[model samples]
Target: MMDEPNPPVWPDSVIIVHDTEDADTMKQKLEPTQDSWNAEHNTFTCDYHFSDRRYAVLFTPGIYRNVDLEVGYYVQVAGLGVTPNHVQFKGDGKGPHVPSLNRHIHKNSGTCLDTFWRSGENFSCANDMVWAVSQASPLRRVHCQKDLYLHDKDAYASGGHIANAVVDGHTHFGGQQQYLSRNVHFGKGASGGAWSMVYVGCGDNAPPNSATNTTITKTRVRVEKPYIAVYDDDKTKFQLRIPLVNDGTTDNLPQVTGDNEESRDFRHVKVATASESTRAIQKALDEGKDVVLTPGIYYLDQSLDVHKDNQVVLGLGLATLVSPVGSPCIRVAPGTAGVRIAGVMLEAPAVDPAKRKSTESHWSLLEYGCEGQTQADDPKNPGALFDIFCRVGGGGDADKRHWINIDSMVRIHSSHVIGDNLWLWRADHAELNPGESPNCPNVSPVFYQTEKDEYNVDTGIVVTGDNVTIYGLAVEHTSKHQTIWKGENGAVYFYQCEFPYDVDTDFGKAGYRGYFIGNSVKAHSLNSPGIYSNFRNATVQVETAIQHPDSPEIEVVNPFTVHLDNNGIIASVINGRGPAAQKQGVPSRV
Candidate 1:
């Protein structure tokens, strides 16, 4: 068996700097990223730093006792999953909703509990995490340059106050501090965690209190940094290389339509009998015609393989291409480059929430007779051995049904785009599959080895386009899901989008990103590395966590470097772990 990853070990190191004197002004808050949803526990707070303007990592209850603890504690873990402390909501489709997890008020909310990381001492954060406005309580009164705000999910995320927020007219945090994207939210066990290679920037064009305008000025800044590297030998965590972006660029982006819409015949197309739009679209492709979709639902499922060059499939002005519920929805495999898939509802089916297990409640096992390996050697979270429970033949169908095997959904974890937009509705398979896709039941944690030559009905969407722009979309409820966007595809711009019930954390092992880049189970950039481009002004919500096969365990596997403003939650970056030890495993540095 592969050895578990060792925790990082380093003399507690701290970086300190101080800068003062700046003028700043604030702009009107235009929109909210998130609206209404279920409520959860776990208190999360962020502190900004200004010395060098770096974002400090998140601090959890695990590290609360050691609040003044220094940074740079070496850690080795067996199955550690990462997450954004909290995120803002930004779902499009015209509406207002409430924030989940009684955030603004802690009166009724109990103590917070996170199952992922175990903290020994307080690791400090003077700068990394970003702050956001709770929907119920939008107005925040800041009195200091670097102040503290509270975001309690149970309180509708309302009520904003600046606890210690005034130093100068210009209000901002230090560079070394950590921040979270305002457009995402975390599940129950995920508030106050730390991650690496993520980016956090101050509000665009916002100035310090000193300045009259809150726009980007002379000293306005954000930060991006990497954490520990996962070692393959005995899973030793190590350091990684950080490539600097050269600033001497001058290449104009290629137009989406390529100088002229390349007239090419569309191949392998089908349409709904109820709508002639499909036939019209098919006709355009047959004659190398460019098909533009009006805002309408064209119900049809056909394998979309564009072998010809210069294919432009534009769904203009709220144009949505809905995925078929029962059958495999849409299959897109672009043979050439510059394949555009914009403004469409790409999704599978969702099992009725009422029919399924309570999303707010964790699965309980009373079958004490069964014995097996477990995430908690402690009895706080008890289950039959098989229920912590092991099942013959990999948990089989029983384990995966409720879980919605993320087999095929929308997978865009492949390319990069400057402008990326997606709107979707998610549904589950005829049956639920709990341990199927989330990596919870995965023993070794490997990608699906199934050959594409053999058609799998559930495959979703995979993307790798750059300079992508997305706007006005609502995506939710999928099973055996794939992804909205998948790999190394960089520079995405999303406007008003959502991810409600479109996920599973599974074992917290196999990576499940609503918007993730493909970085198999290898978390090393030096020996084996993963890559990402960038995303700006995006929104995500309700991507709940599932049973991780390596849960309660910790591992420092290869982590995907997600550098963004507002993104990702529930599950953060996960390290590697082993079957032998997954319960309450603390991370130790090598």
Candidate 2:
């Protein structure tokens, strides 16, 4: 019999920072050129906000000194060990000195309002930390020695989700508008928030639902996101480990499927770059090779099919997949089980209708299964999508004629799928081209013109699958219902949504709901959902934020709605259960 060959080495972009490295060695590896290596002067940096590069920095299991890390756009930093305790960061003497996220350039000078697309996982920090970020960012399985601030100095921020983590000190929300903390151990509990703050399956010390906070003591079922870990004895070997589903257990430690015994070897993993075509990548997936997409943008003419069970598609440094020809970026086949997609962004690029293609717009950015549904493989072993962001706009130039629109951002046709930390946005605002906006210069106008309704998406998510579970989901600026669920046995832990800013009074009154569960559904669980509306285009009053039949099997908890500006009003939180949110800063809860 022939011996199996070793896989190819990793690319130059995947840098493994060792514990013994000094400043010079780090700079030599990270900063090939000053122009290319965009970072702030202090610590390990990647501060270029608009740069196109992607990077993944992995730290070996050990201690480190004088290394204050600062994460920036398109960067992912993680420990190579099995758990958070495998990698420890020594403090800078005064306080806990964990790696700080990229500083925000808007509002307050040094806040983290605009920090996005960076992640920290499976690591321990010695001192106090600040992670002020918005959507598309996640912190998982991290141990913080001191208090964690979600925002800096009360600056306006809209962050994000924290899961399966331990914070020894208080987790302060500060000026953050909304956030979710799931299955976490908050040592001193939590405080602060401008609009909504949710806690689900948290420690006993966590606060309960009140006038401002929304809390759920337990969840029905949850499967933590799968991750990559290195061997303790041989760090060269890597494996993708899928966790076991939790039966309402709130423990911070993740339970793997087989005590870490069952995992896929790195030799079978394919490291793909942006230069590779979609066909080549699809072929690799079809051949049962787990793929790692390095930091770059991939343009796909058709969907990248995920057909194999237990296959992993991991993206480092915000790997982006764009569909420019009105097709889905990725599609999972029917009855596939244990397929994981993590740390990836799916985008629908703008295309002119006259560009020799079908006049129809994009159907969806991502589809879990084909249009014809099938029974899921195993109820306990479902497919997973974590830290995935989907967008319908923001890719094309500022020309209105070329803007591409999508009907829906995500469509789930497979049963028993799990998702965490998803931000599906229709892009209320996008970066404008130089000639489009003279006054604002780089930023887009507040909203698109009313006549350009063809550029906006209709819905953010549509679920036709049964037994689906989602934790920490956000959908924004969709013209119709932000989320529509027509399946049974569905569970949503935390959902945040904003109505279309361009909707008029007549449309807002009769057009949409923030969350719509079809009357045919029998069993569902939804908790801590927040819906808001600004309606900058016209004064509008919505009838309800959520609409669902009052069935005994359906459970709704801590649903709330907010009117962000004076132009909009939410008449009831859900099914006429609460008072209207008429005031700008007030929230109506049920």
Candidate 3:
């Protein structure tokens, strides 16, 4: 909460501070710079991370007498026009309230996030912590969310869209920064200045999605700081304190099947509360029979580890096997080989106990997380395991939102294709301590070790062995991107596949990620740069920026900020940043 009083007017503001007064002089008198290290390249691999605590960033520091903001509340930049990148704003000029305008993409690549501050364009849609977003008009500016040069949340974005920003500070006299229909030029030494979007102005409104506004033909408008009285005096600024919902008892854990037989035929397989479902699955494997699951809710309180080779686990397409979103639904131990998984929609819940009520996504399936034995301490498990594919994650219980988790695979055919499915939750393995109260409820007691460690923390699907092949598979999420944990190496191959959402599918929480073994494959939905990597393409249609597909409620805004890293898809790298020649370069633009 900002307690500063609104002044008659805001004189000037600068996001980043510098010693020089004139930008042209600063440009002319500066030292030649090193190659610009695009943050996307690093951020893509850096895993999507969000600050638990609400935070705000200001390049230049300031004094405060009655500022009531907390650690999360940030200061602002002074000297509006000079330090940030140069931005071009367009306004309708008719009045304070104007019709909306059209939007366009930046053809050239220079309007990067970091450079935005220096560009004199305060359309900080990419990094919210640095500056603020506002809507300007003849009367005043409002602090509403709008697309701009830089995002206020400060995460890596796929395009140079400066529209998805909002005003964070006191509202003044600015509005959404509308861009020219034609590609405009943005010069260096002009990154963090304010700009305006047609018909849009500052307010507490949320950011809108990309749309067409054929009604207005304005050229541009410049952004300005709101009056000091615009400071928020009533609200509170706190970190995002929501925790993973936990189930007090591990009673919901699945019961393994390999240990029994009579239950295999589905006769006594069990129902919604039965614990023998796991035993039945195992019993079917022992008898070498395809275990047919009745189209009802089957409960196997713990993870259902498929240990039998050449086993088939079948489920009705409409039937659902609900698990707490983000919780491991089906797990394959390193001991299981020659596995064929398919036709089931598995989703973890935000609250484990709220199984039926939780609509979060699941981490679906994978061959295993051995990384073909290269990253695994046991060489026998190295890419040597034989695992197949499936038409899983597409089949949901009552809702279309589904999730699945798989590790390394031996040979994945279209059978394990993961076909078509709509997943809304994330495979987020994030959680609070076990001793603490459940972040949400019914969430698992398993602690999330996703802190870029050596432990096996892969969430979506981790495969670490050899001979991994993915053919004609489409993976995606409207809520968030999923991670495919590819450990130390890649015997991994993708053929005619699509990876579109590079901005959301990954959360580079780990150090290792081998996207491919065979260059013949294609991934279109590359979440953000590297992702937190979902997809688009020949086979799959993708939507949304970085987010948790299994998280239930889809974030409908223009990606305020996204967090990635499916520790599952990315495995451990034997060599940091790849071996030789593959040094650190953009794999494909992400």
- Judged by lDDT, which candidate is best? 2
Distance from true location, Cα of 191 in model 1, Å:
23
> Where is model 2 more than 4 Å wrong at Cα?
1-8, 28-50, 93-111, 232-234, 249-261, 356-362, 400-402, 435-454
Better structure of 1 and 3 per TM-score: 1
Q: What Cα-based lDDT does every candidate model obtain?
A: 0.23, 0.74, 0.24
Q: What is the TM-score of each candidate against the true structure?
A: 0.31, 0.89, 0.27
TM-score of 1: 0.31
lDDT by residue for model 1 over 1-590, one digit each (tens)? 12212232211111111111111210011111111223353433211100111111211112111111111111111111111111111122111111122233435541121110011111212332223331111111111112222322333221111110111222222221112221111111112222211111222322222211111111111101111122234333322211111111221111111122122212222211224545545554555433334323355544333333333443321223433333233322322333333223332223343555444221110111111212112111111000000000111143233433224333332222212112222221121143445331231121121111111222233333321222111122322322333222122211111222222234123433333334432121110011111111122322322111222221222223222222333323223211111112121111
Best by the TM-score measure: 2
In candidate 1, residue 32 scores what lDDT? 11
The segments of candidate 1 whose C-alpha lies over 4 angstroms from its true place after superposition are 1-248, 251-274, 301-305, 324-333, 349-406, 412-419, 422-590
RMSD of each: 23.4, 3.8, 24.6
